[model samples]
Target: MSKQRPNLYYTELDLFILLSKIGLRRKLKPSERRVLVKVYYSEYATPVVPVLITNGKIRLCGDYKLTLNNNLIVDEHSLSTSEELFNGLAEGDKFTKIDLRNAYLNWKVRDEDQHLLTFNTHKGHYNSTRLMFDLNGPPAKWQRKIENILKGIPGVYYL
Candidate 1:
């Protein structure tokens, strides 16, 4: 049989614990609960996927496909084609590459929308405060955000 590859994700800790302190749990305070959106009932929460250890750190994520991916209205931001990428460029154009580390974490989910990102684990319930990679719309959302910010800047292109 082939290996059972899970989209692998989860671990839990006390509310707002640092990455160094995973696997610990504590009850959320009222104010902290305001921001975290704790799922009191597992019925409303999606199961956390699987867990992996990378660079001696724990990485937790969810399989949103089993939950939010289908129902969500995907952002319809179309991508540029190869021809479009080259359209504004000239011969011998110097190129530079810039990558934003932890780029998804830069965008916060709207206050009303955070609960849509919530997931449940054996340990507890939780939600993302910022955009996560597994969500269906972030690529388009991020692309649109970048495009909006870079609109008037000259000589800049994104794929």
Candidate 2:
């Protein structure tokens, strides 16, 4: 007999803890809730998929194919730009990377404004009650949330 593969799942409790870190509970609508679930499932299903949410933006994890269409998510110039940014940062004398606790969840999403960042998944499409970044498109409104988080942090850079 063939062994069955593990059906990894994100329990409601697991999602609760994750969403709580971002303070996003009670904010997601039915559709948005469904979408977030789908993301977790898809990512888990494909270990090769890149998973990154850095600087409150979804940083390029790997070359991804947009589920909206089969279009490749990377362009040559963008990859080069990403490489340059990494190379420049690597040359820095000192580096301190700070990752917030559930960064995106820290911001609140109003009921009326949840539809703007909506996205669809193979399971279904849903809007985010919280913010999501589009590295290729204009910054989302939650950019301010990151700004505020950074402001509260004390830092000094001298040339």
Candidate 3:
């Protein structure tokens, strides 16, 4: 990472390579149509402690002071509320909970919007072909998709 600017970092080269290997991002080649956009980093407090895996050794993550203004709404889809979720449970209800790991990443970003989601690193500019975390629209989009799929199923209610 760069010392001058917390957001500006050289680690993007390695991060981008890892992401590409995991099919989350791709390197923009000369022949492909490029959508050049600037990416900003933001810091937020999370319940989970941050850790970094460097050279196969785990260590406490460094603190950075870069804030990006997402200007996005939370829970824009008006999905289930806490009360609704609780009410769905009965005293003797036998229910199964499914946690879709990396649910957001599973959704592909539209081709047109890929350019706007491009990020620049020391190596090169890359685009997120799939949805990334902290985006306001992803939750709602995912909720809608799930609702549509679960609709008209036998005794399947999305609470």
* TM-score against truth, every candidate: 0.64, 0.29, 0.50
Best by TM-score, which number?
A: 1
Residue 65 alpha-carbon offset, candidate 2, angstroms: 14
Across 1-159, the per-residue lDDT of candidate 2 in tens digits comes to 113332222224543354445434345567555434333212212111223365673221111123221321333221225565465566567676655433555344566644323333223334444544432222332344445555544342111
TM-score of 1: 0.64
Error of 3 at 37 (Å): 14
Considering TM-score, where higher is better, how would the candidates rank from best to worst?
1, 3, 2
lDDT of 3 by residue, 1-159 (tens): 112322322343555455444433454454333323323532222111124356663222212222111333345677678786566564435777777634866676787655434444443444556654444566677778888888886545564
Give the Cα lDDT of each candidate.
0.62, 0.36, 0.46
Off by over 4 Å in 2: 1-97, 100-105, 135-159
**Candidate 3 Cα misplacement greater than 4 A, ranges:** 1-75, 152-159
Quote the lDDT for 97 in model 1.
66
Model 1 segments beyond 4 Å from truth? 1-39, 51-58, 100-102
lDDT assessment of candidate 2: 0.36
